[model samples]
Target: MLLEGERDTILKTTSAVLAEHGARREKLIPLLQAVQEQLGYLPKLAMEEIAAALDIPAVEVFGPATFYNSFRLHPPGEHQFKVCMGTACYMIGGQIALDSFERRLQIKPGETTADRRFSLDQVACVGCCSLAPVVVVDNFVEGKVTPTRVDGLILSYESNGQKVEQDSQQTEATNTDEAKGEEGS
Candidate 1:
């Protein structure tokens, strides 16, 4: 369910997009694209608003939205994990790598984590048959990905997040000390 503020924002943005695209059935795809571009993903309320504007059933809008793999229904996470499931990858052990990610992240493919830290997806291929069983982490491809490698990858990212937090806290403390020194001077 969307918060009241989020619902209102979606409604307003959908309204503006409808005004630009008009109520033409031919413009359905482009209209949806425009709305997604603005909002990053299509919320349920935004889709309903779009359907009403086009004078079509909500299911009609949902058909194309769900049909296209490019369209996302939910917001993505900070990190994206794309596991290749092509013939070569599958033969090599892509499924196992994908299973590892699902287990560690506690979210299945096409789903983001509850904390919004990671989103997992399985793609048909990453065009690296030579490097079968590949996993793409935040656009960086890792070849020959195994279950153990997946665990290490997740740990590295988690550690990096903690390091960033600690760095920011240290910077804040330094700024506070400098401010105190200036006040004394």
Candidate 2:
């Protein structure tokens, strides 16, 4: 929940937006978009506020928000994870990647962790076919991901934010460590 002042700010902005609608139903999209832009996701309270100010039904406000894929009814996770499930990705084990996440997260696709730290979702394609088994974690599209790679991905996100360069370095270090461990064994 937002603090009073923050909620006021959102309400002020959204109310002004709704005021300009002049009873046009189409205006709902942009109004919702504006409020969502201010807040990452639309709160139920915001819908009620909008309904009251606009003289519209709360159900009317919810319909468009629910219809749009970008509109998040609940607060989104801090880190977003998406796996490509396109034809190519599927043939190369996208389902397996999805399973890896379900097992680790204990949540199905389109759900978030209880801690609100990670959100999991699926997309038809990430547009990187060469990397058929692709997983995108916080906008870093990883290719040829194995199940173990999911753990590493989660680790990176759970840890302090790691940059792409840091990821490369860590991958190298991990490979080297694995080689050493194998040699020792």
Candidate that would win on TM-score: 1
Best by lDDT: 1
Candidate 1 lDDT, 1-185, residue by residue in tens: 45448787898899999998887889999988998999878888888888888788999999999999999887677888899999999999999999999999998888887767788999998799898899888767788887867776776676664333343445457668889999999
- Model 2 bad stretches (over 4 Å): 1-6, 20-24, 106-108, 111-116, 175-185
How close to the true structure is residue 122 of candidate 1, measured as C-alpha lDDT? 92
Error of 1 at 128 (Å): 2.2
| Global local distance difference test of model 2 | 0.79
lDDT (CA) per prediction: 0.83, 0.79
Clashing pairs in 1: none
- Model 2, 1-185: lDDT tens digits are 45448667767766776676643666677777777877777877778887776688899888878888888776667888898999999999999999998898887776778778888888888799999898887768888877877777777767876854577569769989999999999
TM-score of each: 0.77, 0.77
- Lowest-lDDT window of 10 residues in candidate 1? 161-170
